[model samples]
Target: MKRDRDLVARVLAAKRDPRCADDLVRDYLPFIKAETAKFMGRSPQQGRDDELGIAMFAFHEAVLSYDRARGAFLAFASMSMRHRLLDFARRERRHADVISLDERRPDGGEGDERALVETIASERDELDERQMREASRQEIAQFAAELESFGLTFLDVSENCPKQQRTLEACQRVLDCARKNPELLDRLLQTKKLPMAELARGAGVERKTIERHRRYLVAVLLAFTNGFEIIRGHLRRIVPAGGDGR
Candidate 1:
């Protein structure tokens, strides 16, 4: 179910209210770390507890400057967390002096300093509009190819089921599953709309298998949607306003 507008409004209000800082932190911490993880390649601690600490700080910063009327809360939070993590990565690369390695432990040796230097140097070279252009192209091409592949898979599934009864049965199952799970349904709908065969292949199941489990898959997607809604709402309310909003 969608959250009550009033409740979301109250939560948003609380984030800005000095008294609700702790409450807001408790509510949105998981969301902050999750969003940050999506954008980060890998951290030294990997999935250690410290990631949560970094995410909490990022979320707090986001909350300090969020503007409620512009968009949904969690979407804003996701954007904020991504920027925060990216900024951290950039800062770590720029100033080697700020970092310290544990000299006591044998396994806690310093990170590859030369690799870090090279990475920074490489970033300095193409960190321009050209990089943005290439990234955009790659994102689009990847999306397109995935859709094409899925479409082919769908066609193959349809072809394989020579029996009309079986094909109709499969379609019915898929429909039923989609109705139960909104997330799975959305992915299926997107697949239908884009006709992507590659995504189907990448999913590591034949299009028919997805079709067969469509209803259950839809249910799982719906669950994710429900959980995300609760977390995302809090996140959007916390985006800090300074610097580039993107």
Candidate 2:
């Protein structure tokens, strides 16, 4: 509820605000870590700590160049962190020569061979993790597609609010209204596959109204999903596993 001053504004105003900057890091570091780990495929032995460190480095880079005029902090951080992790993964692979199936173990003993087999197994596990990450990404892609069909934009309605409190309140109101309206709700769900005009016709509303509602809806969903898990809970009931909000 209390948005520790707008980090972007604070950064621009003073050219620095320790508190605001720290708050921004606190708000986004976990997200950066989670997303980066998902993209990089965490190793059971290596753990996520290395990836977390890389993400933090990426976050710091983002903070230096963050432009409020461009986009939300989360969107910027997600893209920045994703690129950082990918680059890090590339560098790591370049440094370490991945062993082949027919390669001999350095120690040349039965015990060494077993250890090598374990290492190869770990590599395979990494591939499996990559597959899972790819699947989740595809799902998110589908989720975005479903949302677009409804003719709503991921527009920033909150940009108009100078104050964070107002922005949060606006998000709440949008969520509340949409949740209470079955026609709008149905349209939102079906939008996963249908076109915006089609969704508007189904909802019996003008295309502009649907567009407006979309910006508001995204704000609330982002807010709820960020801290409360409320949106995910609603999605669970509304969308089945491997199914969009149909």
Candidate 3:
């Protein structure tokens, strides 16, 4: 069952604060690229790949349009991305309503070519769908294990997640502080603990806020610091607004 409340909360939060949506986009860039790469059968260059652009557009569409009715956000996003990719592929292949009578079918027979083409496409879609499902499962499992290293779980993150948009952005600022100073993260990895004072001081967030949301920050910072490509893709860039050092 879809978590309607969570979906609604996200929608409301995003509507009130564009940062929420932007953060989501930042965190999911890797996932988007993965979908595009899977379709293209190669890695896409950021600026050069039209397919990647189509995939991104589709992803943004999913972010805005997703609801409990969509089942799951990422799943919906993948489906949307694939559909856009397919549409682009079809458009590119169309040339002046042209068809080749001499074209050989995949099975080496030519009658009902259009029907066979649709059949082939359906099979490919099923295969791609299965592959993407497995990939999503792996990412979740891996992320869960990573959280375990910090003595944390998804429940902890869910319970500790900042409800207010400002609080959420403040947590993002904490992350921004850590990113500027690599050793703070190093300290975290070495000790399996967050450097609270340093993070709060550097990021200019209140130490109490950092402490209160330490569990959530742990998971987030780990994703940003570690090579959690898919997770990193979802994160939006943060520009801290007048962090207080004193």
Candidate 4:
């Protein structure tokens, strides 16, 4: 009971700090490998096998999604990994079907099959687009759930978000400060609320402005802090002052 309680606390901590998530996953590497080996019928090589990579991604997803309501963390993670393994199998089978087009056929000439493969590839653009869409959907769903914990939603965020360029830049200062000092985020996670006074001071934004746009700040902060990968993919386009926006 005590060990399970500690793990639950650790998972909640991971939800607050991205680095905590990394460390938690590192500690569970043996368990993750065991799960991958179960699916693979042999031990998965750490860097060489795709199965290990998929299992790690699944474990990360479990970290992001697990709550006390979900019961034990490992059981939840095991299920997530199993589902991903099944998805990987399906994707591999589809890839095999497409790649087999390059195999020598007794009747069909190489030029004829090559042309067919090209036409099909152009039409489907198959692999990358489909994978990206699926990944984006999952990220959006998880982000939405996280936002809800703070009594915010996508529509609420959209309506409350700052419209003016200057106001937007002020909000950016808050983000910059949080990036430098992650304690604000840790407080938000612990209390399920933002530290407005300290945040405003750190970012040099007026406290009134922070109050005016609390939900927007919360949404953006949560997205950037946690591992909402696909949803926060636009971070590259947001450049800093006098920087290359990298």
Candidate 5:
């Protein structure tokens, strides 16, 4: 684990220096290939496949954008590669066509094709719903564990969350402060406490307001700093892209 972190730090440093970029890419070529192969269901050819090219570019982007707050660098890089491959497939219309209901039955009988179609659709819906529920459950479990590290629980977050728009905005201000200042987040993680004074001063919000929403602010800050994707996705509607806490 320490080794991976060291390598990620090195790659990030290399990203900032043009002279080291090529070496960084060369060293991590296997990683790029593995990520691509995971998505493609087959080992990607280094120089023969377009997906490899896209993965290489995505890996480069990951090195450039990765931060300590965003969790493991390899996980981020894999996600970046997967998303790029998915987007490329979408643009190229690479998805397989649906099987035709009119095709001859494998049973060598005049099967009820319409019934088969309905059954397939119903099963697909059930499977999709099950997968989504499982994913949500896992995300919540992981989030709860993260919250525990800061002496918090899901119940605490729910009960302490601000209800009024004004208070909520104030909490968002604290979150923005933490997000903008990595040092603040590092301090919070190191001390296992919210930097209320720092956050209030940096966000230009009243100290009293920061104290009142301390729990909520801590939860929100942890979500951003830990790269809680599901939580962040859910908050997208509440938080503005400009980070104004609106």
Candidate 6:
């Protein structure tokens, strides 16, 4: 537990100081390889495999985007690497639009004399969709687990969410304030409590209102700050593009 906190602190510091990025990556190479190897079902060799390079980049990204609220840094980096490798595999599987008409058949028979495009089906889409659904399920499960630390759950967040448009807008404003103010977010994560007074002041919303929608606001803000891309993508409809708090 202490080690995880220390690592997260180092990652946060590295994000502010560009010079530390390389050292950070170097120190975590073994971890990166472990994550990549787990996803690939084999160990990746440095400077010899493309997957290692992708995992390194993903780890760097995780460093930049990680928030302690999202749980352990290693877990976050592992998920990032997994998703990146999956994406790479999908790209590699993509077939060319046109193939030789006289290409030999897979059955070692005579030439088909037909474009490979004709034999292609919608299997790719279905496969991609299945992968996406599985990824989403994993993300939600991780999110729910993190929410447990705050004495909240997915059900709590859903049930506590503001019902009215005006109330929802108020909660969104609070979330916007947290997103723009790193100090506010840091305080929330550090204390495991929301800074209602600071949030109300920064968001220009009433303190009582902020208190009322505290759980919902925390859930939304955590999604944005924690680099939960899947969860955040689903929240686009509720929260506007910019941090205007509208």
TM-score of each: 0.39, 0.40, 0.51, 0.61, 0.64, 0.78
What are the per-model C-alpha RMSD values against the true structure?
15.1, 14.3, 15.5, 8.4, 5.4, 4.2
Off by over 4 Å in 4: 1-5, 8-120, 239-246
- Per-residue C-alpha lDDT of model 6 across residues 1-246, encoded as one tens digit per residue: 568678877999999987787899999999898878866669998889988999999989888977655546776787788789878868766634334534533534575344355444465677677778777776787788778889999888989889999998888788777777777877776677999988889889999998888888888877766656788888988886545331
Give the TM-score comparing model 1 with the true structure, all chains together.
0.39
Reference-based lDDT, each prediction: 0.45, 0.49, 0.70, 0.74, 0.70, 0.78
Candidates ranked by lDDT: 6, 4, 5, 3, 2, 1
TM-score of 3: 0.51
Q: lDDT score, residue 217, model 5?
A: 74
Top candidate when judged by TM-score against the true structure: 6
Worst 10-residue lDDT window for candidate 3 reads 237-246
The most accurate candidate by lDDT is 6
Compose the digit string of candidate 2's lDDT tens values, residues 16-120.
765666666676666766776666566322244677777776776677765432234454556566666666765675455354445656556656654454466
List model 4 lDDT by residue over 42-101, tens digit each. 999988999999999999989998755343467568757866976897677667567656
Please report how far candidate 6 places residue 101 from its true position, in Å: 8.1
Pull out the clashing pairs in model 2. 146-192
Which residue pairs clash within candidate 3? Answer: 26-233, 26-234, 26-235, 27-233, 27-234, 27-235, 28-233, 28-234, 29-233
Give the alpha carbon lDDT tens digit for every residue of 49-168 in model 5: 899999999888877877766655665566567667766865454222245544443444566334344455555567556544544565577668778877888788788888999887
Candidate 6, superposed: residue stretches over 4 Å from native: 1-5, 12-20, 41-49, 64-76, 95-115, 119-121, 242-246
Ranking by TM-score: 6, 5, 4, 3, 2, 1
Higher-ranked by lDDT: 2 or 4: 4
Model 4: per-residue Cα lDDT at residue 245: 22
